[model samples]
Target: MRHTLKTLLLCLLLPSAQVLAEEVQVAVAANFTAPMQVIAAAFEQDTGHQVKASFGSTGQLYAQITHGAPFDVFLAADDSTPAKLESEGATLGGSRFTYATGALALWSAQPDLVDHSGAVLRSDRFQHLAIANPKTAPYGMAATQVMAAQGLLEQLTPRLVEGQSIGQAYQFVASGNAELGFVALSQVYRDGQLSNGSAWLVPAELHDPIHQDAVILSKAAANPAATALVDYLRGERAAKIIRSFGYQL
Candidate 1:
């Protein structure tokens, strides 16, 4: 009787330990950090799986995935990267889906530095305006598109400070290295409220829509934890949390 009880306890604990050992590794876009962190926390609480996330420019993450970076999922700031991965067989076909739509905003740490009308971009109050590197960062591409649409690209080029990623661009302005910069709306918020800063939400008409996407890597489709993470992302609870972070569905 004692032996049978011990055997039963071991068998029960073994499956739980195996589940706990499973972890999903995700490569995430910088703009999605805040919401992803919240989503990850909630996922772990609701499910036993753990997620390890690495945040960076979508372009950089794409390169890493192509070179076999061991990422189970790729959450990009734009649809292009995930689409590319799917086309190249790096991701599971048909697994790509738009997760969020990001918004761009001109932000400044200084009070009243940026007006609601975004007149500060044309003002001489600041010598430099930080933007992400358009060639690499999706937010940078959007910023460039906005400037071009407003016919300010040529004029603003001379005063631009380029950041490798949107997060870095936000840091440039937040640290006062640049008086104002274009950043993701998600970065300026905490618990659904804007942090200490002045900002102007750029109109969507100013640029192409930022349709963020996520995909399961082809190599990880069989990974139980990876599949669970993807399912969690599509579930109602995760979607609600993402929406609360200023992301558009």
Candidate 2:
């Protein structure tokens, strides 16, 4: 009799939960893919709202949005793109904010290949360093700035391979196509630490802070789920996850 009563109660609650659930479509920056995936899972578990995350370079995603992509939210790798979207009427007014401050890391798949102070760039001991396309990726631009500051940009240009996105650049090193690369700290870190490989956390002064922003799109104006997801991002749960991945919230 008790089991029958519990089953009846469960059946009654299921419909209400289903009615409240909505899926949110999110366009995420490539460097933020891993962390976003974790956050998305947590969100679904906590609120029963499904998150469909699509990852790409910020520039590519911005172009797609302008051309009418159906993403409910846009998480850009830099503040400028969100600002541009706001100016172009692509975003819901006053819906944008900096979600995280990014950090760049010099990483090598082979342990001990990168040093703490980034002196490996001067070593010239390895060839074929990878970076994202500076034209489309903010982290790539920051990497260039860091190289230039060290007076190594021109010197290392011949050895550089550019990826379409930070994920691709990370793959270049992870797959052994390149000896090392400059990638987002979040890519190689979790729980405030790296799992494997050698990495040098770049000096913040070497380049401008990569202030990543999130905005609700104009297309999602009617989406309560989209707004809920954005609010979740700014909440304590999301902030803790972001920090775990070495990002500043």
Best by TM-score: 2
Badly placed stretches (over 4 Å) of model 2 are 1-21
Error of 2 at 233 (Å): 0.3
lDDT of each: 0.90, 0.94
TM-score of each: 0.91, 0.91
lDDT, candidate 1, 69-130, per-residue tens: 98998999999889888888888878889888998888999988899989888889999899
Total clashes, candidate 1? 0
lDDT of 1 at 139: 96
Backbone N/Cα/C clashes per model: 0, 0
How does model 1 score by TM-score? 0.91
Error of 2 at 128 (Å): 0.7
